[model samples]
Target: MESSLPSTQILDSGESAEGKNEAKNYNEVMSTLPKVKSLNGYDYYLYQGFWYAPFFLEGLMSVQEHFNPQSTDIFVASFPKTGTTWLKALTFAILTRSRLSGSTTSALLSKLPHDCVPFLEYDLAQNPSNRDLAIPLVSTHVPYSCLPKSIISASCKIIYICRDAKDAFVSLWYFLAKQRRSENVEPLPLEKSFELFCNGIANYGPYWDHLLGYWRASLEFPEKILFLTYEEMKKDTAAHVKKLAEFMGCSFTLEEEEGGEVQMIISLCSFEKLSNLEVNKNGKHRPDTSIAIQNSIYFRKGEIGDWANHLTPEMGARLDDIMDQKLKGSGLKLPR
Candidate 1:
């Protein structure tokens, strides 16, 4: 394949420019990858058999080269728009509650969930030392197949979240609409995007491949990977939080529960509470694309079965049938 990279990259930043290991050849490497049009008008690359947005590729490359995992590290993994923000907020609150001063809810005050639980393939590579490494908890949208071998071999625990295909499709379309507006490009129409989604052409997709990679992993390593669905968590968040806490080895005590700690955490991380926070409402997050997005962009209705409002019944059935085919005999079910 023809490379756009300088024939040589200082693959190791510490190495001399005159020597080998140059990784600065990102553009070169990126140009050679298999590319496809996305809902937002930019090209998505086929990386390891799945598609990913171009913006995340650079950071992900650095991550692959530099990330060193520890047994104590915890990860929250999910495909886009599958309650990732909420899961991040909940995990941040659950794990940090015992360490904060004053009220337990203080940990989440004025924070975006994305800020609290940084992305492994982006934020961590940007600042590995930002948060004190005390039981480092991070998140990733990277498919399990593409994750750094270090992470796969490490004893770290991973929690994977996914949602119903129809809802996930609707959510991603709306999300990409924001990115399209940011880029000053015409938004990919819903019908067009939905078709692409069904074909597994969105960012971080081959959606079935992304889901099954982790699903199969969670089954093989039950203790290391906890798989949860968005609908289940929403049906009973409190119970889910407890389960999350226990899985992370931080179960709330009887005294803490009696004192209303669990409920307090739930209220503080609730979508209503989070969406209204001044920080989330007005804050800006800069992605590798250098686009400053209003943190509020991440705050959507978050309602389950919302696909009905946006998609035709036939559209839903098409996706449901596709998922059924993909999930058949896998022993995993996604809400229809």
Candidate 2:
């Protein structure tokens, strides 16, 4: 548990020399990385051909330099807005079901899934006090190529979840709008957001490239990478939850399986059940930073193909065409 990064805020930022040095390094990366306009007003830096928010870039750099992964560690990896919250909830439940005993509910009832499984880069690496967390379970939005080398070299398992490109974009627009609204800043227009998104200029984006990075890696290292798509999970959640449990090295026992634990976990983490919880509806994930986002933004209509409601036919087909071209001959076909 040497790398267990605690969730509770610890005000040790100015006290530790390592924290200062990490902050200095983060600043250096922030200042030197090539910068571009983000979908919103904040600047995103083009690093390794994809765009990343400045804070997350700092986190990527910090996690790379310091996060030490153990073989037991399980990383839930994905691009933003790709059912990350859902995956985090399911993964946490599967891994910690032993502690749940006979109850259908778990900590998820009280904490946001993001709170239960903190982001390796954005949540932990961005917060200096959380630099060396001892926890084994972590999630990340960092692309596969940019992930901490320790995660790869240490031979840990990664559970990745993806969604249809169109749906992912739709979810992202709503999430961003909610964030900006919370801060009283004007959100980007949907058309403008779509334009930047197609160009691969959004946060942790160039969507096709981000998806392709892990898609290809999962192909090359099937044992180490359990790639999942949101559509597939929504189609049959129980089966996928079982797959996740197995991949995470905690497959349900015959008794547990027969006892309806799988279904219990699914229901416990379902969007409907979670969205109504007072904690999720009213709470805010206040990291040590000044920015505190409403937990409610994380819970929208977790419907597949909600893009139809948001994007026109032309916009949908255009993104699909782009993804098809980008993934052509790569043996990856995104759900249309």
Highest TM-score model number: 2
The TM-scores, one per candidate, come to: 0.91, 0.91
The segments of candidate 2 whose C-alpha lies over 4 angstroms from its true place after superposition are 1-22, 126-135
What C-alpha lDDT do the candidate models reach, one value each?
0.80, 0.80
Off by over 4 Å in 1: 1-24, 101-105, 287-289
User: What CA RMSD would you report for each candidate?
Assistant: 3.8, 4.3
- Per-residue CA lDDT of candidate 2, range 33-147, in tens? 7887777767788887778776667667767877776688888988889999999888888877887665445888888988888778665665534422444688888788888
Range of the 10 consecutive residues with the lowest summed lDDT in candidate 1? 1-10
Looking at model 1, the pairs that clash are 4-28, 5-28, 9-22, 10-21, 10-22, 10-23, 11-21, 11-22, 11-23, 12-21
